[model samples]
Target: MSKHFLRPPGAVAEADFLGRCIRCGKCALACPYRAIRVAGLLDGLEIMGTPVILARKSPCYLCLKCVPVCPSGALESRVKKREQVRMGTARLNRKECLNWQGTFCRSCYDHCPLFNEAITMDGELRPVVNEKKCVGCGICEHVCPADPAAIIVTPRGAG
Candidate 1:
């Protein structure tokens, strides 16, 4: 059920996250982008008060500020760089993408923090995800021009 959402960077694993997180809002407080939120009752009882990011609402800027402040170590303090983050991996829906549909929009590729690294232009001038290079910061999803978003992020361990 939690597969629909994404945890902050440096999160160990879902099961371990739940066990280690103390429901403190330090992560949310440290997030200057306001991308992180504490799960509420409606989010489901098991994850209540835990941090989560709703990409469309706001996206992580890879600030790496939240991890160090997590008193419970739920967000690993060892994560100090964007490349080390394993928040999730972004996937694009070709059918919904303007570039894939022949309109030629590079919003996702242009805005990606990883630049030419994570999302690259293919031979057909369409955006392609270099999965291994993606840090799943959600910038691609946030920048998508498509109505329902042509791109989305799949959190690590979500499967």
Candidate 2:
């Protein structure tokens, strides 16, 4: 299973985030969507109490509330607009997509926060992810009807 998960929006580089985060849970508290949660002990001591987001379960709405509330610089306050977030990038598994399989489906495209810019339907009426425009908010993955999801968000900095 993939261990990759997202940090709160505006999170700095991983190494700095791990060190600077004080585990105050302020970011989580600020989130109206409850999209932020503290990592538990099972997540490993290094990350325990650090904020995490399981996009499929609950994706960030890019409200930017978490950024200003962070006492630590873990989640940068500089991100004032939705377009500035770089949480990760969405990648589509064409083989798993219903549209690509000849059935009609546009859940991902319909649910994308960026709308037409982030996800668009091709000439075949299949969803195509615009990596450059995608904020990796995981809205598409969350709304996907396919089992295992036809698309997923890969956290920023994760290869």
Candidate 3:
């Protein structure tokens, strides 16, 4: 299965999401962060016109705007907290991380919306992820100075 792709916040399981989605572009238009995008022809017929978030391009800020605009119930409309939105999980590649090599960088932790809850510092000041607390929003991945990004957010099922 392709675990790398993610649905928006409050999205149902993949099979159900694909079935219920009506291919409308409301969700994408409603997003203030412009994090949501409609799948292109290259994405395949099953996902065309469906809203998708490409975290590396633009991370969802959990503004919850896209949720209510999903008329077909592809995305549940009532999420009240950042912790309730599970887009994916962030993983750290220690070998490529500047902090792991003692450069004193905390870009991922600083950019994380969950901050201390999802990412904490160890005694060495290296960022540690609390997987359960991470919503996989991808802000950490976007802000990393590393060429390949030391921190990567994987879609929920992908990991």
**Model 2 lDDT at residue 91:** 92
Question: Candidate 2: which pairs clash?
Answer: none
The lDDT of model 3 is 0.85
Error of 1 at 154 (Å): 0.6
Candidate 3's displacement at residue 70, Å, is: 0.9
Q: How far is candidate 3 from the true structure (C-alpha RMSD, Å)?
A: 1.8
Model 3: how far residue 79 lies from native, Å: 1.6
Q: List per-prediction Cα lDDT, in the order shown.
A: 0.91, 0.90, 0.85
Candidate 1, number of clashes: 0
Winner by lDDT between candidate 2 and candidate 1: 1
The list of candidate 1 runs beyond 4 A from truth reads none
lDDT of 1 at 67: 92
Q: What's the lDDT for residue 67 in model 3? A: 84
lDDT for each residue of candidate 2 in 101-140, tens digit (9 for 90 to 100) = 9888989988888999999998878999888998888888
What is the per-residue lDDT of model 1 for residues 1-159, given as tens digits with 9 covering 90 to 100?
A: 354678999998999999999998999999999999989998889999999998867989999899999999899988999999988999999999989998979999999999999999998889999999999889999989998899999889764
Write the residue-wise lDDT of candidate 3 on 34-69 in tens digits: 898889878887787787887777888888888888
lDDT of 2 at 95: 92
